[model samples]
Target: MSHAEIEIERRDRVTHGDYIAKLDTSDSTAKLSWTDRQGVRHAEHTFVPPEARGKGVAEALVKALVADARQEGFKIAPDCSYVERYFDRHKDLSDLRA
Candidate 1:
C-alpha cells in the first residue's frame, strides 16, 4: 500500500526535551530522535501517537533521518526497534546503517 505523503526537514534546533525530530499532519503529530553517541549520530527514536499509528509517520521519520545521515555522511546505529526494522524492510535506506 502507498504511505502518507510526508514532508521532511532538518530540525533548526532542539527545543523540547525527548524530541529530536517531528512529523506534523493536519490532524496529528509524531516526535522522534536521532541517537547520538560520542559525537556520532547513530540511530533514532520515533513516537507516533496511538491514534496516528498505521499512517506511516514513523516510517517517514526514519526515512528522513536516514536521508539526513547520508547527506551528512554518517552511519546509523538504530537504537529504536522500529527504526531498525524500517531499515530491514527498505534496503535502499540501509546505506546509513552502522
Candidate 2:
C-alpha cells in the first residue's frame, strides 16, 4: 500500500508500546516497538515486512513515536539501529534524545 493508504495504530501497555502500521488493501503490517524505562522511551526495533517496503511504514512508525514523546514530555533512547541512525540524521530531534 502507499503511504496514504496505510493506517498507523498505537498499542500501549504498562511498560511498552508499538506503533503498528497496516496496509488498507492487504494483510501486511509493520511496527516500531519501544519500551518505557525510568521516564525514557527506548526505541527497540523497527520491522517492515517485505511487502510493506518502500511505502514509508517504518518512517511513519517512528514519527508516531516521536510525536508521542514530544507531546508527552518523554525523552527517547534510540536503541534500535534504524532509530539510532534516524536520530543521528535529524538535528531537530537532538533535544529529544535521552
Candidate 3:
C-alpha cells in the first residue's frame, strides 16, 4: 500500500521524552529519545506492532525521527536494531548518526 494509504499519527511528548507515530489501526510505531551528558538526542527504541509489520511503518517512524533530529539539530544514536538497519539501508542519513 502507498504511504498515503497508511495514515501516521504523531504524538510528541517532550516531557516524557518520547515521539510516537501511530496508525489508525491498533498498530502503532514509536521512538524513544533521551539526552546524553553531551546534550545529544538519542533514538533509543522503536516499536512496531506485529500486525503492522512489512508495511513500512517502522521505516516511516525512523524517517520521522530523522527529520526531527535534523530540524532540531541533534544526532541520532539509533540504539534500536531496526533503526540501525535503517541507517545501513539509507546511507544518505549517515550524517545524522551520532
Candidate 4:
C-alpha cells in the first residue's frame, strides 16, 4: 500500500485498566497497551488478531505510538515482544526510549 493510503491511528481506550493502542483497519483490528503507572510509561503488550498478522498493521500502530510518545515527551519501556523487535529493527526511534 502507498504511504498515503495507509491509515495509522491510535485509540485512547482503557482495557483492563491500561491504556491501549488500538489499530482499526477497514475490517480487522489490533491492539497494543503500555504498562504505565505513576507517570512512568511502559510498553506492556501488543495484541494482533490472527487475521491481522503479516499485514504490517502492527508496525504502523507501533510506529505511530512511538511518534506520539516522542511528541508528548514521554519515554517508552517496551515489554511487548513485537514492540521490542520493532525497536531493535528501527534504531532511529531508539532515541525515544527510556
Candidate 5:
C-alpha cells in the first residue's frame, strides 16, 4: 500500500479516456474515467476497490490524470466528485481547469 508500488496508465478512446492505477505487487487496481468534448476532459468517475481504499490509489490516479492534462495541453472539467475535491485542495493546478 505504498505510492511507490503503484503504476498508473492512461487509456484513451475516441471520445473518452481512463487512468488505471495498478499495484506492482498485487492484482488490485484503481480507476478514474472521463469523456472528451470540444477539447474539454470531463472527469466523470473514480473507482477504488475496497481493498485499495485509504492507500492513495485514487490519489495516484488523479495525479496521473492531471499530469497528462498538463503535458497534453488540455483542460479538465471536474464532473467526478472526487476530482472536484482534489481540485479544491490543489489550487495550484487551477490553470488546468475547464
Candidate 6:
C-alpha cells in the first residue's frame, strides 16, 4: 500500500513523555519520545508487522513526527535507524535535527 492508503494515528502520552503513531490496527506502532532533557524529542522505534512491510506506514509515522517537531518548535534526535535514514534523505529538514 502507499502512504495515502495508510491511516496513521498519533497517540500522545504527555505524562509519560512519549507518543506513538499507530497504524489502523494496534499491532504496529512507530514509537517516539520526549525522553531527553533540553526539550528535544527522540524518534526511538518503528515497528511494522510483516504484513505491513513495504506499505510506507513507517515513513508516514516519521513524517508526522517530523511535522509535529516543526510545528511545536522542538528538535528531534532520530535514534531509530529508519528515522535517521529518513533525515539523511531529507536534508531540507536538517534544521529540526538535534
Where model 2 places Cα greater than 4 Å from the true spot, the runs are none
TM-scores of the models, in the order given? 0.69, 0.90, 0.75, 0.72, 0.91, 0.78
Q: lDDT tens digits, residues 1-98, model 2?
A: 55566678999996998899876646867888889999899999999987767877788788888889899999999999989988998989999999
Query: Cα miss at 31, model 4 (Å)?
Result: 0.5
Query: In candidate 4, what are the lDDT values of residues 3-42, reduced to their tens digit?
Result: 3444655555442223333334535456666655554467
Off by over 4 Å in 1: 1-5, 12-28
Error of 3 at 67 (Å): 0.8
* Model 4 misplaced stretches (Cα beyond 4 Å): 1-9, 13-28
Clashes of 1: 2
Q: Rank the models by lDDT, top first.
A: 5, 2, 6, 3, 4, 1
Query: Model 5, 7: alpha-carbon shift in Å?
Result: 0.8
In candidate 2, how many Å is residue 8 off? 1.0
lDDT winner among the candidates?
5
The alpha-carbon deviation from the true structure for residue 37 of candidate 1, after best TM-score superposition, in angstroms, is: 1.7
- Give the winner by lDDT: 3 or 6: 6
Cα-based lDDT at residue 63, candidate 2: 83
Report the Cα lDDT for candidate 4: 0.65
- lDDT against the true structure, per candidate, is 0.63, 0.87, 0.68, 0.65, 0.88, 0.72
Q: Give the per-residue lDDT digits (tens) of candidate 5, residues 1-98.
A: 67777878889996998899876545866799999999999999999988768888888888888988889899999999999999999999899999
Give residue 58's lDDT in candidate 1 (0 to 100). Answer: 73
| lDDT measured at residue 17 in model 5 versus the true structure, 0 to 100 | 80
Candidate 6 Cα outliers beyond 4 Å, as residue runs: 15-36
Of models 2 and 6, which has the larger TM-score? 2
**Residue 96 Cα positional deviation in candidate 1, in Å, after optimal superposition:** 1.6
* Candidate 5: worst-modelled 10 consecutive residues by lDDT: 21-30
Candidate achieving higher lDDT, 2 or 5: 5
